[model samples]
Target: MRFRRYLDILFVFILFTKTTFAQGNSCTDDSTAGPDDPHSFDKAFDADKGYGYVVYGDLYRFDCCGTVKRWDFSIGDNGKIELQIWRPVDKKGKIFKLIGFNEYTVTNKNRKSGFVTFDVPDKERLSTEEDDVIGWYAPGDSLIEYTDGTSYDGIWKVAHDDNLKVGDSVDFSGGLDQGSRTYGIQATLAPNTAPKFDPMPDKKISMDINVGTTIYTVKVDDADPADVADLKMEMTTKNDFFMFNTQTGDVIVQSTITVPVGGQTVTLDFKVTDHCGAEGTGSLQVQIDYVGDPNTTPTTTKAKTSKTSPKVKTTITDKTTTDVKTTKETKITETSVAPVATDKNTDKNDKTTAKPDLSTDQDPSNGTMSAMTGGSSVDAALIGGIVAGIVGLIIIIVVTVVCVVNKKAKVRPSGKDPEKANNASKDNAKNDAKDKPSPTDKKPPSDSKSTMNGKPHVKDKG
Candidate 1:
């Protein structure tokens, strides 16, 4: 249990434990807390089977691996012992729990009788790191001294109102009391405070990475909860691609990883240890990029011929009328200005506008063409200069509305001569729209009507 908040939230700094402690130095296992080492007949339990319960008491560890901060028990038994420190998530001795705790009480008195020691402070110290142990609890029998056979590693007991805090997680290694003997349990080491990481950055692998994929989680940063509780994903150089997690530094993708084509790289290297051996390294890379022959068909890249795109297109077809350009299918071509226009004077109503649709608006690869000549036909000088500028603007609006209706019929008799109607409107505006009336001498109209009789000098302002 992350040592019950010994440090979390991405640890920032703190590397202090430079060894130093002296209650009988040399790593103290016997710094004296005696009454001749918890034995008044060495029977803290099995008191002839009146064995009350709740107690783990002995297993111990402290072969110099650091910081226990003092503990040296021996007890007589008034009650209340609590001094746990289990940290053993399987170093092979099966499972174990409770991270670090400390309490101490003993009043009245009875049995073995003797020292006590304690100090523990630095926030419940006890951070052994390798098989770590050193237990004790109380709610019954005398309180110290045990000595039976031997197997240990797990031991549950509960109920003094369910007590066993600090993330309680026991196993008891299946009891029948295979053994239990730890006279005045001890621990005092001191130096051992490493573990760091939170500065990694060398990963670079954007996208494609198959085989079971997970890729990276490790962040580690510290203040020792026994150094970020159990972390250890070391891989200085091992490959088959990936697969981390030596106690959650997670990292997966175990194989089939590649990088070698038009562009390539590979990398990998790793490290992040913690059970007191301390480490923190990184790298990952990957990078690759080929692309060619993706099923062989992706080559569209010719776009550099610009001098104003639109090399001529206007194709408006449809046999229309008075330039009416209609024709959702049109016909009625008896020319010579409708020369007796047959099909019963074929005039199913004419009048129309809007153009474009010369078979898909020109250039179906040719037709009214001009894809710079690659599309053929129809460019007879850009359609004869756009049909002679729309037939000279429809013959000057039909000879200025027929000389303003023949000069308004000689000034309508006397709506005032007004200087002889301004000199007959300047001689009927120089009368000359080819003297009017000529659809080859008129007669054909009626394609339902809308014909300048087919371009009579192009006059059909209607």
Candidate 2:
């Protein structure tokens, strides 16, 4: 008893799983709107259609989550046809009752032939099994026929039945059909699904590619079994250099994609709609990088250096040397050499001393001592020549004065005439005294100072 109970539970679980799976996988059926018939019965007889009933069963099995939306059935009479679901009485689907319908009607006028369609109510869903029956009823003067045959037999009724059972045998004696009915059932399904890209790997593109080149072709699909009706792609950010083809999901390079950064990513959203008008969205990412051309060799740009401007650099170096020479000795030496009289004199000295002018160009590798030494030598030679020239001029002037004095001495009278000599000497002395302005000389007022015996005396006032 325990084993049987477990088995039963397992069966129920399997059945529930099957139902859920079927509902989840539901799709729009495309095969002629109805189930296929394995047998064929091309009969050409019109049934007496005065409020008659005919019931047909599907040859194949039907799963759950099926909705009968509309149907297509052909008729030869100018009348109406009514359709309903057959509620099953047992698991075998051998007995049923006409319990569910919503008064869907089809009117035919003047031999209206070919398949005519009528919409069913939304609430009416068909929970069916293999070879389950679907019933149809027509008013008077209407015509219906069997277009195909199946291995299984169908039921027929001249009048309505609240509850009906599929009996063991059916003969023409009981007025029942022997083949499958020709009708189209349009069943729609609701599936839980979304759209997705066809699992594309990430894409990469080099910055050197030309504009309008196809980056890659992307494809989108609906997870449901129905056909995707509309497909489109949109970029998250608008880029002037890139384009996306909405219909085909092809990302193309419209213009140059310039990036200051080396690498980046472009993203887009993709949407697809199934035939049932359900939409789904997904995302696509594309990586972009600055890559050189594959066919050409890459080269690097070098920075500009001061080595290129030699003149400017040399001037700067010279100024730097000048800045370093702040010592007192260097200053004195430079100051002494700075007073150059002429470039010609400087050149002559340079030749004589075998020393180049300090201002002239020299080996840049030489230190500052070379320049300062050359300058000091030139200055010393210049100062010595000036000093010697001044000393010689002074000596010539002194000798000329001495010679004149000697000549004057020789030209003087002899000492034989003593008195005359003495007078002359006294006159000369007086003249000399007048010219020299001796300290004893006084200004004559009303009374003047008189000298006696060669000595100065004060004159008294009387």
Highest lDDT against the true fold, candidate: 1
After superposing candidate 2 on the true structure, give the runs of residues whose Cα lies further than 4 Å from its correct spot.
1-193, 223-226, 229-237, 291-363, 367-462
Report the Cα lDDT for residue 454, model 2: 92
Global lDDT of each candidate = 0.47, 0.45
lDDT of 2 by residue, 110-217 (tens): 245434545544344333322234556665543344565454645455544334332322221244444555433333333334456676677777666787898877
Per-residue lDDT, model 1, residue 275, is 51
TM-score of each: 0.28, 0.29
* Cα lDDT of model 1 by residue, 370-446, tens digit: 22221112232244334334433443344445456756686576665688888887888768565776665577654
Pairs in steric clash, model 2 = 41-149
What lDDT score goes with residue 290 in model 1? 40
